[model samples]
Every structure is written in structure tokens, then in C-alpha cells.
Target: MRFRKFTSSFDTEDRLSITIDDIARPLSSIQSSFEGGKVPSEFVAPLTKFAERYGGGSFSSLFAEGKSARQKQKLVEEFGSVLYSMETEEVKNEETFLIWRDACRDIIDWGLKVDFMLDHLKQAARDFFGYMLRPSGSESSCREIIQMEEAISQLRKKLLHLEQKLGEAREDLHLRLGDDISSDSMSCILGSSWVPQSRASRGLY
Candidate 1:
């Protein structure tokens, strides 16, 4: 996934792209800059929270740990919650919000990929069981198959919930940001060219 970093500018219309290294500078460096009053005082807390949660990791590093579907989903949900909790007033400080919004978008895009992976795994497991037929008629095999099915069911439910939460979080962001938030911006954040699906399409509302 490509990660775009925004430079320090208040004009949202003009984005100055920078390197990920520059964007994901150490938490200590950010705090030091904040203490020197280089950045707005209002940004200190949210930046600190983000650094603590992510260990000042780059977006690529964070999303690269997609080996575990559950971990990926949790990471995406946490990122969304962080974005949702950000102060709307900070939108005026275009650089901060844009950087964070881009991070959120990266997480959402990564989560979508993870969702596909999990769905594939689930289907593969089902196919394996279907091909097993009688499975030697062993009680233990039967129990294990039943357990696997139950686990898949639970995973499916969890993925559905994750989608719902992400949708709601996106809606909250739109409401807070107002007209400034556009389909292009959403697409950028979501890492998808298409606009967000309607409530009916998502089985929401």
C-alpha cells in the first residue's frame, strides 16, 4: 500500500507530499517539537496517544503485520476510533488532521485486504471439511469439525461487526468535517476509487 505524507501547511487544498520517514518521525521528536511550541499545543495529547499506541511506527510497518486477521481488524478499529475521537477544531490545523486522516485511510484499506484473506481462509476450511466426507466416522473428528464450524461462524460475525463499526466511524467523520469531506477524500482515506457504499448497500441504517 502507498502511504502519502502531508507537510506542515494549513491549506488543505495544496498537499505537499513528504517521505514516510519524515511523516513517521519518532514520538520523542514530535513531543520535543511540541514542547518547543513548534506545533500547536492542542495537538500534544492526540499525538502522544497515537505514538503510545503505535510506538511511532510507520504506516507500512503497522499494516505489514497482516499475518493475523484478528490483529489486523483490531488495529483498523483502533485507528478508526482514534480518528473519530479527534477534535473537529483541529481540522483548521490542516497538516495534523490530514496526516492522521491518511493514516486512518491506510488502516481501512489494509483491513479490507485482511477481510478478504480471512474470508478465503474460512471458505478453504469449509471446503476441506466438505471433502472429508465421513472422516473415518471417528467421534473426535466429528467434534473437531463441529468446533471448526463454530469458530468460522464466530469469525464471520466479528468481521460483520468490524464493518459496521468502520462504517459508523466514517459517518461520524463526515458529520464532524461537514462539506469539507468529499467522496474523493473518502476514497483516498479508504484506499478505494469508488465512493463509500450507501446505508442500504451496507445493510446499515
Candidate 2:
């Protein structure tokens, strides 16, 4: 099933790039950077909350267990290594860069899905919390849940709308490339050849 999904993403040049160390080291470094002072202040509360509810302890408490910041960073770094190792093992025999690219696309797709889901969930939570502020615990409380359901429904609708727009854009790119542009594929076709390496020119992806 995963392989099927991977094949559908796109062809790429990362076929020989599937080493455990290659994937694990970068991911571990990224995770470790976050655990260190690299984390932004805006992320502190939410990250701390996520770590506590899902990661067993408060951020401070978790750090406390290791005796030092370096130790805490090491723990998350190790965790990242373990996760990447598991990911690599799962697809150790992948035969193509399409598989690698597909895996990356799947991850990106899942992230977008989770982002949309979390938007609605956060809105629902706000509504629920607002309702709780009221003294009444009657049938009115149920209305909050209904409001949350409606918000989630709207979120799904917007997501579908965006997906349709993206599909149309891809189709347009295909048609345009066939007409005038002479590029290898949609990615290279849509991405201007002269685009430089900078945050300003790199499109949302």
C-alpha cells in the first residue's frame, strides 16, 4: 500500500539516496536543534503542551530528568535517530527515487491534512472553552459541540476547494508545457529556470 502511494508521487534522482545514516543524521540534527535554544519563543507553549500530553512529561520536567540541557538535546536527538532508523528499515528495499520522492510527498500531504484538521480542532477547542465559561451546563453546552462540527465541516470544504484548485493548476501547467514551454516535467516547468536559492523566490513548498 505504501509503495503504491509512493509510485504515484513522481520520479526523482534520489534513488541511491536511501541510506539509514543519510536520513537519520539529518533528522536527528533537526530535532536536536529544536531541543536546544534554537526553538522559537512562539513554539514554546504549544511544543511544551505537545511534549507533555504526548511525550510523557512537561518540557522542563523532561529536561530535568537528564540533568542538563545537553543531555536533554541528546535524548531528542537519539529519539529522532530511532524514528528515522525505523522509517528507513520499513522501506529498505525501495528500488527508485520515485519511491523516495513519493515518500516525501506523502509526508507533505499528511502534514497538510493534519494542518487542516488541527485548524478546525483548535477552533472547536476555543468554542468549547468559551462555552464552558458560562454558568449553564444544560443543552446549551451541546451547541458548542455543534458549532465545532460546523467549523470542521467548513474546514473540510475549504480543503477540498484548495485541492481542486491545485489539481486545476497542475493540469494547466501540463497543457502550457505542451504548448510553448519545453521542460522535462511539471516541477521544472512551473519552477522558473532562473529561480535562485532564497526564501523570497521559493514558492510555498
Candidate 3:
């Protein structure tokens, strides 16, 4: 039996409406900045590494694992640190700095989009449970509800598995990026207050 019928009430259709174009624009802008010599020469190597690994050499590849918010957020933090460091240089080349700065902002924007998509999914899950709890009068409805319960249980298992994988990925990212780039520095560069907030605290993961 199709589970889509049961999930239809959760308004998830728009969640799936995120187009490749929406994801590609920022990535393409970053690439263009690199190619046009807008990014500083010192940053090119590390930025290239960051793009290939996190961006998968293309925006579409970044979302290949299904709009993972954790992955996107990690990318933002890593690259935002690099961008912030670049901006701290004493050189007064405003044009080049602006180009690079916009590219960094684009990365954050891309990450926020992923976060928004995940939020939609979480809300949809909540709505599904709420809808399922409503009283039903018919035998057919009851049977469908039973099927939905089973489906939701399986979904919970899958979500847990994904969460575990995400945790592993986070550890891997930390190992690859190293400890030299501090969160406090990134937060200062991004103009955001830094505090230790676990994944659970943020309602993400």
C-alpha cells in the first residue's frame, strides 16, 4: 500500500519543490568568483578543497544525499571561517573583498535553504502524528491508521539511522578540517553570538 496517501495531509509537496536551480546559484557564484580572480590567491587552494569535498564539484551533488541540513551547516561553518580570515587582511582592496564576501554569504544562504527544508520535514512529521491521533469512525479508516502506524514506525527507524550517519559525518568533518579553525572566530566573522549549543538544542540532527 502507498504511504503517500496517508502523508498527503501533511503538506509535504512544497518541501519537494526545491529545484536544482535554487541550489546551484550560490555554488555557481562561488565558482565564478574563483575563476574571475575575485577570491584571494592564498585562499584558492583551501577553498577548492572545501568546494570539491563539501560541494561535490557541483551544487546538485551537494544535495545528492537529500538536502542534509547537517552537511550544509558544516560547510557554512568551515568556509565562513576561511572567508572571515581573508577579510581580516590589512589590504584595502574593496572590490575583491566584496566579491569574496558575497560568495561566503551565498554559502550561508544555501545552508539556510537546507535548514528550511529540514524544518518542513520535521513539521510534516509532527502534523502526521497529530492527524493520526484524531478520532476515526470507520473500519477502513482504522485499518489505514494501523498501516500508517507501521509506516511511521519504519520511518522513525530510518530517521534514527540517518541521524547516526550524520553524527559520523560530523566527526569526519572535524577530523578533516582540523581544530585550527575555531567556532568563536567563525561566529565573530559571521557577526553571530557564539555559545555552545548541541545539535539537539538547536532541534536539528
Judging by TM-score against the true structure, name the best candidate.
Answer: 1
Whole-model lDDT values for every prediction? 0.48, 0.46, 0.48
lDDT of 2 by residue, 41-121 (tens): 333445554466654654444332325666555444433333344334333333323333334343334221122322333
Q: Rank the candidates by TM-score, best first.
A: 1, 2, 3
Worst 10 residues of 2 by lDDT: 110-119
What's the CA error at residue 94 for candidate 2, in Å? 63
Per-residue lDDT over 5-39 for candidate 3, one digit per residue giving the tens place of the 0 to 100 score = 43453333222233223332232225224522354
Clashing pairs in 1: none
The backbone clash count of each candidate, in order, is 0, 0, 0
Per-residue error (Å), model 2, residue 130: 22
TM-score per candidate: 0.25, 0.24, 0.23
Candidate 1 lDDT over residue span 89-147, tens digit each: 22232344445544444455654322232233234334444444445758688788899
Evaluate residue 160 in candidate 3 and report its C-alpha lDDT on the 0 to 100 scale: 100
Model 3: how far is 15 from its true place, Å? 59
Candidate 3 lDDT trough over 10 residues, lowest sum: 19-28
- Model 3: how far is 131 from its true place, Å? 22
